[model samples]
Target: MALTVDKLINDDRFCGDNVFQFVAFLPFALLLLVARVFLALFLWIASIILPNKSAVRQMLSTLACWTFGVYVKTKGTRDPRCSVMVANYVSCLDSLAASHVLGTISLRKWKVPPFFASTLGIRNAAQFVRKQHFADCPNKPVLLQPEGGPTNGKGLLKFTDWPFQIGNRVQPVAITVERLFTNVTVHRQSDARDKFPWSDALWFLCTPVTVFQLRLLPPLERLDDDDNVFAARLRQTLAEALEVEMTEFKWEELNRGSTATRREPPAELVRLARQVKEVLPRVPMRDIMRDLSVTRSVDVTITNFLEGVTPFTPEPSDAPTPSTSQAQPRYVTPVPTGVFPKSAKERQLSFQEKKAQMIADARKRYIERHGLSLALNNC
Candidate 1:
């Protein structure tokens, strides 16, 4: 399917596109955010105290869903025979909703706190393998998001093959998340590029309500099909179910696009670098420009330079003067009044002094050459 980057990823914010609505809802959103912080803390501590499979933990999970404004509705029954459940990634809470309804352990690739992952039924790849290897396994099935990352719910990303390789029969679960007041479900813009999972969670708290609809499809047996074919078929099945187009776009492409968008213009970078150079005259312009490109803030670049977080070689100052040919007619040149520093550090330290002295010497020369002093005397 031919799909643009905007169709695959959400480029909007939680505050939304309407300036008037954003301003009207700002106070309520802030209040809700502060309350959710405490509620999340309580849920975190409770998850730690209680066992993963305990009834109390389950109740806490339900309470978390209610408190955080997450409502999940399941349409079809999950197959008991399938060990692996592949789903379309839509939001950070996809696993949480699936785990609550289907009792499935979602495979996580990113590093999160142990309790946090446990609370959300997220397991690392190693833990997933260990669980599959061990004789005593939990009754819950393994949930895998083959898309590797979340999208805007408008399209399905190409599925990876490893999830299909895990088991012969895989269940396809289609999850659709909808939020009130804003079109943004997951952040894919350049500004929130680095603040992922946390940013998503914060938006969830800010939003009044988020509804998740999960449709569980029947188990598909691989039979004679290879991993790639099996994965493609499953992806097509999900696309049909979700009523969205299947795109060849991957998470890597999304990351590259966001990075490209984050890059500042050349003029902006130069301006920021000059500001940093003003504060740190000893720091080379090249180093300042490099750091400014990444930080994109004059204050941050200056702080990084002062903290010695940025390592750089001092700019070269001492160079041999060009040799003149003896055969050429040479005119007598006046000796320089200002002293030149041999080292970069010395030059940086005495730059202002040298500048002032040069200006004074130039003024003196102009007076002598043009007879300005004689004119002043006559006046």
Candidate 2:
């Protein structure tokens, strides 16, 4: 069908040859350039005039992404509205993956283009270190690749400088691409000289037909709360999400909490470094401290990290919360009835609609104590 369409477009005998028509239309391409220049200018201007204007930035990002091929997927508990989230950048796919999960409807899209979603926050750019003038714009909560370079599951490379510069604990995520996005990069650069940005080269490459997989874990962290702890956890979680074999040495226990302690280096590490050099080098020992921070053991301290969510925060003292009974068959007391439907499927029942599901409900305490998955069910 596409071949036929192409044929039809090139067939001069038909209404018009698409190839010729496209080239002919170039005479008016300046109009498009003017439009884009203005659009970018207007956005930059509006963003400046309006303080913390998130909606406009979001619209711009969505529109830009709509022109590309991508989307977002979010799981676990997160407030999409949180403007300062840090996440890992895996093949540049984390942004879209999180956006889809956020459930923000795009105000625009291609008539017949790949699915594109976007999670636009603000971008944090620094003042000039050189002579170049830096425009002040809203910071975007984007995915950052801690390992400054790309990693195909080799041991975690020391993270990039962005994590520290951004000052926002990144939401580390893994981008799983069944097929590498190499073509996208190649074609994109090929078109750099041409008027078209070789966007199509990637369009076919990023198509979902062959690209099927879950996004690696997302960076849903508070950077200020715990710096080293969060980054280390994010690295491990990202590795696990991709089913990558992580490297570990003795004293391989993991840190369960979201925060890391300023403790001494593990015995194993100090021992190994000793064997390599008689005199320990006096370098910034942060890396040595970090190596001992997280462990590979299952007993890693995670409980202490996810504390402080009161789903039961009283709705204003005066307002009464209607405690209408849930239609679920109360299993308060498991009275055994041999006749109680041998097949559990027989007892499976539909639940009555819930009016509200709070974000705090997604906490582990809530899930364990209440046995409820506090997520937007329909979503």
TM-score of 2: 0.33
Q: Worst lDDT window (10 residues) for model 2?
A: 1-10
- Clash count, predicted structure 1: 0
In model 1, which regions exceed 4 Å deviation? Answer: 14-18, 130-134, 183-196, 261-379
- Using all chains and alpha carbons, the TM-scores for the candidates as numbered come to 0.64, 0.33
Tens digits of lDDT, candidate 1, 231-255 = 8889999999999998887876765
- For candidate 2, the lDDT comes to 0.34
C-alpha lDDT score of every prediction, in listed order: 0.70, 0.34
